[model samples]
Target: MNGAKVDVRKVAGEGVTWTLLATLYLRAWESRLPEPILGDRYAAGAVERIDYDFAALRRRIRPASNQFLVALRARQLDDWSRAFLARHPNAVVLQLGCGMDSRMLRLDPLGKLRWFDVDVPHVIELRRRIYPERGRYTMVGASVTDDGWLEAIPADRPVLVVAEGVLPYLTADEVRTLLARLTGHFTAGGELVFDASAPWVARVAEDFRWAPRDAREIERWIPGLTCADATPFTTHHRRIPVRRYRALYRLIHAVPALRNAYREFRFTF
Candidate 1:
């Protein structure tokens, strides 16, 4: 499937691409627009091509970050990360496999920072159509596994990597390879921030969590990289008791039986 390009126009552009939360975030963006909204909204009045009850989906997709519990987490992480980038004006920040996240708009960095939004070519292609890069924000169209893209990025500068809802879909080996490659290339004091699905919790996420990927084997993939427990609020989202929020989500979705539903981890390179 590598290098296979699906003409953005020709894909089965009916429902969502199954990137779940990211797609929902995009939808929220569109909901703010004064339309002729020509982005992902389909002819069927559906944003995602998936055949689900959109009404039901809308109610269930209320992100915790939108709530007090998750809102604190979001501000904490985003503020801290933005501050870090501010200090490392020349540092390279990579949002690997970024789907349709509006982090660029949120961070809204000026020309001093060098930021990249990296993902599969098609996603970048799609994002470009909606949100064009202005100055410092550039979209690097490549997967995290492909080192070829790294060549275009300056290795001399420190790298700050941010990944949200990405690794669980990868096999552990793929996760490690990506981590090793990133850490190996980063300058000292560089950091990578991301969250993980506790093994058991991650399994349940395959269906409920919405994004698809190759990250199921995250533990086995890379032999190194420290897991600095970052459960408390480090970014925009604060850490809720994993069990508490998972239960809330379960009860919110009426799936309370799901165990170990929320897990998180972070580390430096």
Candidate 2:
């Protein structure tokens, strides 16, 4: 809720979940900027409520450019989501690996559609404390790769599956299996939107487990899953404010592989 505050020091100590705090912090930081890309006030509020070592995390992450990129990525995803929901008001939205993201609040599609935020248990518990209860919005505490959770969600309506900052962390096989399961479950057919890193970026980012050279490569992984769009982050590099960061993005854009080193992809099944 809007005015709720909780100590999240223990949750912040977990290894994988720790990354959520960094993302939450970045969104909050960017929201405070004079002209923000994602202006997520809910994120700013959540950051304010959660008591953690954000100062130390900020120092470690050195979030100058990261803050911009994170907000921009979120803004892009939000735009796509809004477009999808507008087209199908009765759609069901599944946000996998949702973490502490305030997308449901930011979108505020209450009563307009069904929304589910799925993540691991501890993260979900933290989210329960931070976010207010809303009609037609559910929080499922299960890993995205888990098959059992899908059985509970209604599949009769159009579905929009979103997995931002999640797929690359999954093994190639896991990514393939997850997408297949999602498409299989939602027989009515819907869209899937998510961002991914290129192979080179994955190689350098030791934590990432899978990265595709081409976004369309996923078409081979799942039959009937066609890539609708693949937009490189560098395509919007001019939006970055800092001169050096913008220059870095321009340099990346000049190189073919690096151009899509990080990009967003949309697919319809």
Point out where model 1 deviates above 4 Å: 1-16, 20-73, 207-224, 232-260
Candidate 1 vs. true structure, TM-score: 0.65
Structure candidate 2, residue pairs in collision: none
Candidate 2 per-residue lDDT over residues 88-206, each given as its tens digit: 88899999999899998888645456889998888888888888658889999998888799999889989999898989889999999999899999998889999999888898996
Model 2: worst 10 consecutive residues (lDDT sum): 9-18
Candidate 2 structure lDDT = 0.84
> For residues 133-222, what per-residue lDDT tens digits would candidate 1 score against the true structure?
878789987777776887676678877787765666666556667777876666455667765544455555544332223233333344
Quick one: best TM-score, which candidate?
2
Candidate models: Cα lDDT each: 0.54, 0.84
